[model samples]
Target: MTAGRAAMLLALSWNMKMEEEIKKILDNKPNLRYVVTEVGGKASEEFRGKIIKASMNAAINKNIIGKNAYESHALLHALSEAKAGVTINSSMSVSFAMKVAIVRSDHWIAVAMFGQSAFHPMTNHERGGFGIMHI
Candidate 1:
């Protein structure tokens, strides 16, 4: 097997929990906050945007630029609080997200996954959500 493939496998097999993931990041850099979103699509964006806005910053502005590179201005907008922010959207599914999260050893990665009971009506597999159907 390829060395890179072996490394990826090792990372995926590493044991870690949800809260622990964030905590690990926070532990390393207490000055930074995390915005956990799914890999792509509108549903994931809207779902995770809520967490970013309500929990991270209330003032969602137009300063966010480009097709990607979101949260560049958002971390700055928070004002006199956190030093920096990072958004992790490595995967759309819970399992894949966890795998990606584990894959990265130096930096923390995260994904917003809804539980089976607490489903968001706005979230659908077509729109990049961890739903019953896959696109």
Candidate 2:
């Protein structure tokens, strides 16, 4: 295999292992809400946009963003980052918003959310071209 392919395989393996480890940890603590979504076979702007919109809507519908002007501004910034295809890792407990982590490989981009149960609905929405797993 080419070096690039080898590296991609390594990353995929590592991510799968990490996901399993995270699942085990979350399983131990059932009280904490955890939602994971994966999009297989490369990342696209459309998929990213959908995730951004869904996440933003979830935050807004949960009253996490609008309650405080500062929080709203922060979320807007996060949305911009998402739009730019930047990875997100925010974990503010008071906002009722979900933290997003994007893991990418040569063939896929996986988005994981950790927060309220409301975020769970955002998973498994990519219609086709991407394989989604929610756990």
Task: Specify the highest-TM-score model's number.
Answer: 2
Cα displacement (angstroms), candidate 1, residue 68, comes to 24
Candidate 2 clash pair list: 42-107
Clashes of 2: 1
Give me candidate 2's TM-score against the actual structure: 0.30
For residues 27-53, write the lDDT of model 2, one tens digit per residue: 464333223333222234554565566
Writing each residue's lDDT as its tens digit, candidate 1 over 28-113 gives: 74432333222222224543444344433222222112223343242323311111112233233322121211111122222223
Estimated TM-score for each candidate: 0.22, 0.30
- The regions of model 2 sitting more than 4 angstroms off are 1-42, 67-70, 79-135
What is the clash count for each candidate, in the order shown?
Answer: 0, 1
Query: In candidate 1, how many Å is residue 98 off?
Result: 16
